[model samples]
Target: MSYNFKTIRPVMPAKDMINVILSKTQRKTPTVVHPGYDISRIRGFYMRKVKFTQETIHEKIDAILQDFPKLDDIHPFYADLINVLYDKDHYKLALGHVHACRNVIDNIAKDYCRLLKYGDSLYRCKMLKRAALGRMCTTLKKLTSSLNYLDEVRKHLSRMPAINPFERTLLVTGFPNVGKSSFVNNITNANLDVQPYPFTTQNLYVGHTDYNFVRWQVIDTPGVLDHSLSERNPIEMQAITALAHLKACIMFFLDISETCSYSIDQQIALFKDLKPLFKNKPLLLVMTKIDIKKFEQLDPIDQQKLQDVIQSENVFYSQLSNKSGEGIAQVKEKACGLLNEWRQNLKPEQLTGGNPNLLREESILQGVYIAQPKRVNQNRMPVIPQVIGKLNRPTLKDVQEQNGGAGVFSFPLQEHFLLENPDWKYDAVPEIMDGKNIGDFVDADILQRLEELEKEEEMMDQAEIEDPEEDAREEMLLNTRDQINKKREMIKEEHHMKMKQQVKLHRPNLEDAKEDFAKKGIDTTFLEQRAQKFAAKKVLQKQKRQQQSSDDSDDNDMDIEGNDRNQRKGRDALSRSRSRLREISRSRSRGNKKVLTAQEQAMERMSKKIQRRRRNEAKAGDGDTKIDCKMPKHLFTGKSGIGKQSRR
Candidate 1:
């Protein structure tokens, strides 16, 4: 039954297909290489991809040995790393492989290293006109040049795209287990067991089915492994046919698992192999099981890792759990939206014109030919076949930002990548400044800078309240180095004088003392001077402190010199008064009362001194008068001029 293009019909919810895929899982895993990149561990200034286990090691070592039958020198460590990557789950296994590869790269570099080691020496010898050695040197230069070439190769390998999506024709991609029936399963869902254990969905699957309203066809394609692409599988013919004969888009999916069964590196490899085919298409990686980690622990750091991997902001992630229909509505909505979007943009006029395809509506017949026979007829016009597998004009990946062509943009995206994904603490794109990953940026780092700005603003407040003594101490720090240098010179002079007394034998160099402190990351502005002074000023300080420490030393000296005679007289008076009192008691017994007690005489003397001091203070105050209005006559009119006038 053909329906006219009135409205895009809704397709089955993603859940129905996901359910089929889940049911198929019990069909044992296919035999596949256990990718080492995900299992390895590494600790450094930077994060790295994981690697294989000991099982992988056995396979790789055996493969490498077979690949390079002539190479005799293999490090013993590779054997250990191989075992770890293939069999060991000790997180260090992945790290071991990374180090092993680095070791291999290093070993490969040794030839160049040895040649360059004597480069300066060889050049010098050549300059001195030594004929026999010069020829040897010329040959050495050839060897060095070859070594340099290997160095370039190593650099290229290091930067290797990890994904090699060259000019390949097709990609059979879909999320994990989407009932994405293989090419043969076009009639029924892909349920048959084909590949060995682990890699169960082995053979590349491709199938074509026509969309009723659009007159175009959709091809069902298999999924590409995540992480990295592998070229180990045998080619599928139907998949190749769709690639060569018809333009196709492979839909990639993920089953119900949050983490991939495959390593990230392996998945990347698989993507790479398929990338070039989708040259201009959106490399849309859809997440079907959105509900798996929906309520699970979404740690900020872990989510940040996810964000870094998937550069796109729209979380192409959504779950389609067949058990409970959570993401089915969103999935259906998205599918219909995509299909409708692709349909509205197509021009009946351009159809079978810009694109070259095998089948077409018979109306545009005159100028069109079936297929490119010679693979390069380099002529004739193009034809857009009936609606091809989910084609979108200006796909989301191709959309450019409006203000400037700065980034890939699509307005349909709900969350901004900056908000959705956590960024590295450091620079998103780092420059290797001082041979370090200046790329690692932190939010706290920026926050700290903001804090510094705030602190700077508040510094004046602190400055106003600063203790004058501490300010003086900080000010002292400015000249500390100068003082230290001066003291150092004095110490040197003392040493010289001390040396003068001895016969002129050898003396230790100044370098011996300079090695006392660490120069790495310490801030020594406050400590350096005190450290030096601890030895320099002790003797003089000790003597002065000792003198100051003796309590009443000055008073004792004053007593000896009779400078304290007034104090002594007061004390004598008090003693005499007590004696007089005792004498008075004795006198009373003897009935003698002629003289007054010494206490009364001393009290009168003390009162007279107090009264005299008060009188002197009063006289001093009365002698000075403060006049506000007039200047003194002698000052105002010169006294000498007045005296001359009187004389005249």
Candidate 2:
């Protein structure tokens, strides 16, 4: 299966990660706090701030680690290939370092949050938050080199060719400048990087084609020099890995023309050096650049070396001139055909008339050939009412001819839609039960009974007529009630309007009151002190209520401890009783004060805030609301420039 790694998330540099953490913390934390605020609220705000920052970093790091492929979870061929490209140990080390940083950041956040929970002042809590964030940023900065390395590796892996090792494949490998890349480009649609210089292709490239409607994979690997396996570099080992893992037809390309600068003897030596890698695989020795020099034109010694390699069993030989595109299709066909035959030979043999348990493999292979299902009643067709013959069916022309063609001819649209027997359409069966039809009952005296019912109905209608005197009395009574209700509503509206005007005139702003008191030589410090004392008392009352509720919960838990596994039932009963008491208290409180709906409450709060802000501005020196007397007329008021072409 070929994989697309493009969807993997992009990695961030260490500096960028630190910047993100700092920016999020500064943007999300509360901007203002005062001594009047509750101490617990202040502590909670800072602790949550630090915890949120740590969580963001943890999520991003975990996403990166999970998105990348794990070596053990992939196919062995891919695992070994990744190991060859980017040393397995180093990759694991990079991920392990990120995991360690994750644990350390979490621990730092937890410790700081615990300290903040018991903080006595806002300044102490703020300092704890700062210290936690500073440590986290410093730790992330240490991963600078590791982050860069992983990002580079991710980019490289995204560009790698997706090769399916399980498919029928043809692997082409040999010395540099020997036309291996050229052969692949000629046969398949793989646009591998090819050049006339040595070592042009330094990585594995793969493409696919179809043979007899079956898909086949074609891999073009880098060329290897005649050196020991241990001394080869990572780029050269790519070829060795493919040769060792992939099950495919191996095509070894050779340049007998000597234009590649590698002698024929050296090319043969390289082939034999990698001979053990080609065991159990169908091998093909391809002679390239035939248009430049034929096999006969080669020296006797060189020709003999090539012949010796081809003489081995299961070894194939072919010639192709890649530049001229000659013998390309023939070589591709022969290689794919041989590969298919070899795969078929590896399949288990078919068994007949033998014990199935002893021949399980053969039985499974033979089970794939299922017999075709046969049809029933093949000799005759059933008489279906809807299957009308063409000759017997009525056409549009026939209907028009019978009804006087273009004039006054109306046809029932559903004439041909009837699927039942023709006689059934007009049958007068009143009811059918259990497939038996019955018609309505008929009696000789039926007309007499109908006449009697109609008379009774007419008599009832005549008796329902009303008297005009009663109607007039009811109408007069309704008119009197309507006039009295209208007069009462008028009185209510007049009273409400007068009360509203009075309230507007009598209400005085808080600032005007303060100024009046000052003119009378009276200090307002007592009022301010009274307000602060009231706020403190309210906070204390809330704390007392919370403490009482917690104590009640503990008592309930202790009561349930003696019950055997039925604690849940007992707790539910206690919760129900407490809930009923709360409901009763809430109803009583609502009855004592005006219970406002959601919309009304929201409007009341908004009005209070607006009035409070106006009062504050009036009492203080009018922070930003004070208007300057001298203003720039041209900037504030001018002919609109939006419609002028010159401005644009």
Candidate 3:
């Protein structure tokens, strides 16, 4: 896994965090509490304040805990680097304090909130709230030192170079001023200080360069001294940590000219000391400062010593001069090539732990077959035409240049059209000639076909005219069929009428009854006399009803006149008394008004002004219709306990 420590959030100091949490709680929760409020409401108000503050603190501390990389859960290279830069125990202790403080704040809030539930008065609840906030702040204040340390660590970590431990890396290390930094600057963009002193690069510096289309990370570690691990400082341990943990191509730099203040034997001894860390890793012994002193110019003994070191260590050796930039490219190429070869030769199980899914196999070779032809003595060669060698064709681009060139030159499209007659390619036929459509006559056989159709239609007409008897028989059959259809329709309508729940009965008038009786030759005088008697009876009854209604209306009018006269007298007396009272109560005003003091008059004027403004702006008043959420989702949904409803 790769890690980018630059994204760790900045840790805030303890005092600042406490103030921020308290201020946030004050701003988010209710601050006002009245003694008149119910004890439950007062307790809940304080409880919410305490809980909110604890949650705020928890969230902040949790962010720090989560953002910082855990040592036990990260890559060994980064873990060791972090341990070297910042003591492992100290870092773990600082984060542990933060985590513990977060729990303490939660417990304090919980205890205070439980006590708040029993508070009977607003004063008691308010005191509990204060106590809760104070205890949380005190718990946080105890971690001031840890918070400051973490904050400093965060700042340093954010500035640390982002290195991918799992990527192809080339680690450059050796004694101080041995041209390691200069070599890194030459190949990559690390650009370290090339001072002629030791420990110029105190921290691990990462730079990236691409080789064979794959990106490679080059880490320039601080110079290490010729001492045991216990005697090494943090600056030197950084290089040791990288060399011991990183699976990279180790380029151990050696100052061939002894210009770095370290002798050749000392550099070789340092390499031998670090040889255990280079197990199974590709190593390159890069001899820097060739311009100052060449290996050939060294004494025979020194050359023999270097050769023995190279052979004994089983490492590839090369020479380069940073000042002259001689052999720098070769050193880089050789390092990358060696690293790639080592990676390619690694066993599948070593990289993937024998996981079948991750095993590398030649999948492209599956189901592939190669066929070999039988050997023959005869010789076979490809034949070529003689004219092919002499053909020099002018391409489209050449033709375009010879013409007017690109946009101005248009190819002759008609020249490429395949037609039966080449000359017909450019021929144009008009759609209309004179007053006739040329398309209509495009087919030479159209007129003959039309004539044949006309002849067929004439023959069909003659055949029809010769068969009059058949036409008459068909007409008779159609009339008979229409009669049968009409009868069927009548029967269907009768059936529908019978199915109705209430059928309308046809009642004949007196005249129709008289006509029917006269046609049947029956005596109609008695029936006519009975009909006239019935009509006379109905007319007499209607007249009697009209006369009774007129009589009743006249009686009601008389009663109403009597009642109205009495009401008029009473209203006159009441009006006189009301006028007298109004005159006695009114103060010299145009209309009836209530007498008011100065304050009352001012209040009335203000109310009128406010009413007028409200009317103009169309604002809602106290009596306006409103819709409030009767049951809030957060309170109504999910599980609830005895006191959870009020808390939610």
lDDT by residue (1-648, candidate 2, tens digit) is: 456677777899999988887777778766577766899999988888898899999998999899778888776777888899889999989988999999999999999999998999988987888799889999999899889888988998888888766667899999989998888887788888888899999989888888876677899988899999889999899999999988789999988897899989998889899999999888888889999999999989888778888785448889889999988888999899788667666643321123345256444643565376677546776686665675678878788888898675766555555856765555554456665554344578989999999999999999888979989999999999999999999999999887754444577655677787678566666656777799999999999999879866766666445454356767887999999998887755465674555665776798888789778656453455555557878768867666464210
Please list all clashing residue pairs in model 3, or write none if there are none.
Answer: none
- Cα deviation of 134, candidate 3, in Å: 1.1
- Show model 2 residue runs off by greater than 4 Å: 28-31, 345-648
Best-to-worst ranking by lDDT? 3, 2, 1
For every candidate, C-alpha RMSD to the true structure in Å? 42.5, 28.1, 19.5
Which regions of candidate 3 are displaced past 4 Å? 347-648
Model 1 spans with C-alpha error above 4 angstroms: 1-197, 203-230, 236-246, 255-260, 263-273, 290-292, 295-299, 308-317, 322-333, 343-648
Cα lDDT computed for each candidate against the true fold: 0.40, 0.82, 0.84
TM-score of each: 0.23, 0.54, 0.56
**Model 3 lDDT tens row, 1-648:** 356777888888887887788778878988777899889988888899899998998899889999998999887777887888888999999999889888888889889988998998888888888888888888999999998998898899888888766567999999988998888888888787888767778888988898866688999988988889899999998888888888799999999899888899999999999889999999999998999999999989989999999888778999999899999999999999998778767655554334454444312222245576787666889787867755766667888889989997877678789999999988775657675675766788889999999999999898776578898999999999999999999999999988968778999999899898678566677778999999999999999999879866775667777677757967998999999998888776767665565665776799898799668756688476455667988878977667654221
lDDT of 1 by residue, 442-527 (tens): 45578789989998979878867858898888889978978999999999999988775557866654343334323333234435
Better of 2 and 3 by TM-score: 3
Error of 2 at 527 (Å): 54
Query: Highest TM-score: which candidate?
Result: 3
Clashes of each: 69, 0, 0
Tell me how many residue pairs clash in candidate 1.
69
